[model samples]
Target: MTAIKAADSTDQAGVWITLRESSVPVRAILAGVLVNQLGGFLQIFLVLFLTERGFSAVQAGLALGCYGAGSFAGVLVGGAFSDRLGPRSAAFASMAGFAGLLIAVLYLRDFPLLLTAITLAGLVGRFYRPAAAALLSELTPQHRQVMIFAVYRLAINLGTTAAPLLGTLLISVSYELLFWVDAITALTYGVIALLTLPKQAKRPARPDAAGRRAGGYRAVLVDRRYVLFLLATFVQCCVYIQYVSTLPLAMKAAGLAMLWYSVAISLNGFIVITSELLVTKITQRLPIKLIVVVGFALLALGQLMYALPWGVGVFLVGTMIWTIAEIAAGPTMFSYPGRVAPDALRGRYIASQQTMFNLGAAVGPVVGVAVFRAVGAQLWLWCALATMLGLGLALLGMQEPDTALARRAAAATPVELTKDPA
Candidate 1:
């Protein structure tokens, strides 16, 4: 009995090690980081770019919203393609389409053309995400999937972290040059993706497998579980978007230094990177739903604190608290839908969720500005805090999915897992 027990423990250790060593997920994540970094640099100046082109505040917002609309569309399109043609082909197509749009932007001066270019570029550019998620899902195992996803998220933020400083220096040169540089990077990404990503794996047909169309975006939209997941996800986004859209403006209004504003946002990303590993460890002992609820509670408290009469020091303290919650909630929320999705439809389900996220992104700025104007920034923060708390309470009773369900769904037939692409 003692020898048998030793053999079982040894086998489990070997399996865990092998899961960690899988290279395919790592490569997909790396490629995604490279592309996102280049795009993020361009994004750092997106509003300024529009203003330079003579767009009014409303127009600029509309253009940005249009970009989000395109992103929403792109997820559906890319997810469908990923299911049919596989991740490699879908990712290549998304990149190529995005590159063409970027080139078109250079020649367009008309507002309509500019709007169209922005929309098209956003739609095509972000299409890589869903396909990339699908690819990562295929390569990653069930138990460690959240950790891999967290690492991918970290990569995205890390890539973007340097963008602001780079943009500030380059704006002195030419914003037009910025556009050209972004375009070049995007094209290069496509070329690398075409050259480096392996062909999709092929497997024998499974008895329970369903058609790709059955896993379409519309199907996922109507599912109650998916809808509930979307609600929780939207609240998370509402809290996070405050950092970019409102928090900076609020700080400036209070006469705080720009350096502190930068510090707050930078520290938020830093916290995320540091806490991701810690969060993964906790997920093993605590239910994911419970962790999610705690995350939301912390987020609410942080936002509410900001609304109070705090000095610059206290404001920074609140910012740190918010950062902690953001770090904990961000990856888990992103990973939740994938865990709940049907195996064959996981890509489509994820894309549908992405579409909802883009929807929130589109609405966040307009709604935030309106809230600030109508009731003051304090009210805006309080309302957001209340919403987060409300969401936490609503989600308190929801059950977490079991490990078997998540793994089986991830490994199901749409993904023909054969060799490690890493």
Candidate 2:
């Protein structure tokens, strides 16, 4: 057992060293994403802020729903922009726009105005993701995609782990300051994109392009497998979003303190940071479809864990379970669109997935809160069932990437081989 443990440690060290060899732009993008995420105050504080200002729970849910709606639209638009204007331009625009909108949010006191501001903020904030993903795909070779994305996820988790603690500190001083800090970080990311990212070279137009107009999103829509994958992703997202949308309110209703909820969230982030990279390394040889199916299963079980009658200890366990699901699923999920997409339509493919995921997020809060009010803690059981359905969908729909690639290569191979004439 001791020898086995030593071998495992050696393998982890090798993976760590491999990830450390990523290029300059990759490192810069990761740093920018980390800094930007650290200042993500909206998800953590937005609901609490609304409730403190005397808004009803339903109203806060609606506001977040609007944000999700805007996010859906933004990702679709951003994908097109990434293709047309290039990834760097798309990312810069998104981050800069997000910063401006966040500042606008700070001054808006009316519910309608605040709602509008938040929606716009979500729109601009979300645009960065598809653009960044597309950029990474462009820069990295196909074989390195999983490891690179794992590094990206690590950066995001690290930032997320710090965000709550930072929010806690900033909110104690003034909520307004939280808005300012968030905006500044976004602006900083924009600057990084502008200064460090190279301009994308223009793609020469295809000779038959004028005759063949049904490309990009139109082409992506016709891919039945990808569509099914999107359906599975939507369901998974809806189930996962409950933690942010309804869990806090549920805890409050159960007479639990806010401190406990914060601790649970922080714990979730910490688990991701500490374990994801190593776990990802170990799982790299596993079938991608199996990994995703298992992730969905874990998600279902985690949700059910919340339905148990125990206290914060049980909740923490649930958090850790879902965190493991996230670590298992996230890099594979991000890599799939890139793997399947044609070079010209990669942005649109990613955007389509993001749009579906965001739509689920938009709907999750409203549904979760309503169900929670109606069924109390039993809401979690229903969510678990929903996630189980998602798992089934994934198993049915997701193809192994290696199998697909092998088929493609086989189709392209010449029917006969001949020796060179001398």
Candidate 3:
């Protein structure tokens, strides 16, 4: 369970045991991911269900907004709780609540009731993400942080890929059946997490300096380096939303079918997983910021291709290009924040990032849809391109952390604090 072994984890030839590492940190990450992905399918279909039940687009947006707002609340609350009580307890509580809410969704059909249920579900489910993220950060050695988070992201996308398709098949039979399936998976994950996560996992102690900021959102904001990364991520999320929010309508206008659109999204997730694996192989040698900029450039190029008057073939090309970019950039983005976070406030730092991520996720759809509605398809791709370019330029302005900082931090950390139990 040493850092070296964690870093050198392997599976049988052609099989990556990304989840089966000896480290408890990796195990906990894998477990959390399983839970997140299993229940996450429920999120994708909420809007569709609302629309089917006679809610307007605006109402559906509002309901989702409420869900995001609820998640925001959970991030703050969970950040504090995870920082105080450790990620294991925080995750267990969050999963239990998520399962409870999913079960409640079955009995509630009215808009108000459903909205309330979704909000609660978001609240409960979101609490675990930051906690799990912080836990991974705590467990991983400096050199392997990016790979760890990359693997974590890969697990999430894998779960997302499987769950929605499963829900879709169930939906073909009955939405009620889909709900039941989601509930069962969620509950199962809750039980698994409770059983597998180490009982003794505890929050690390704060750095001693009474005057220094120790925990919470305020502490995270005070770190100018983290703030810069946060700003960069904000812009990235703003632009990334088009894939889900505006891309479908634009493709439809250009004669692509909804089936292809779904294919593109799945492809995007697949490419993201692949890119993360590639990035993990080279991250020690390459600068992560440079890698992320490369990703942004790819995304921008894809958007530009979409802006052109080409047909379905070009559309597929654009999606493939952006898919690679997503894979390259997404894992490093989260991994970097975890690396920079102080051990004591890791929960808060991770939560703040997720908070911003969710905030942008909520705002991106609203803005992308609003812009698409007002201007039409011609402007959509251009806007996405512009956003990507802006983020790339912004990335250039920030200072990149070198191996020295990571080494210094690792040297300073107490061995008893981070060692694996035999």
Residue-wise C-alpha lDDT for candidate 2, range 329-392, written one tens digit per residue? 8888877787766666778888998888878887888999999989999999999899888877
Per-model TM-score, in order, reads: 0.79, 0.78, 0.79
lDDT tens digits, residues 1-422, model 1? 44334323432222235336768545655655556574555455767777787778888888877886787788888777776677777777877777677667656778888889889887788777877777676666555566666667767776676667766777789876766777666776666666766676342354343443444666676566557777666656666577778777777877899898988877777777667656654443345665677777777777777676665775677778777776676666667666666655667877877876776666776677677767765754665565665475437523454643655456553765799889
Clashing pairs in 1: 24-422, 343-409
lDDT tens digits, residues 271-371, model 3? 67666677556553356557767778887777777777777777788889877777677667777766766666778878877877877887887888887
- What TM value does model 2 have? 0.78
lDDT, ranked from best to worst: 2, 3, 1
The top-ranked prediction according to lDDT is: 2
**Candidate 1 positional error at 291, Å:** 1.5
TM-score of 3: 0.79
Candidate 3: list runs displaced more than 4 Å: 1-20, 47-65, 108-115, 169-177, 199-214, 255-260, 273-275, 372-422
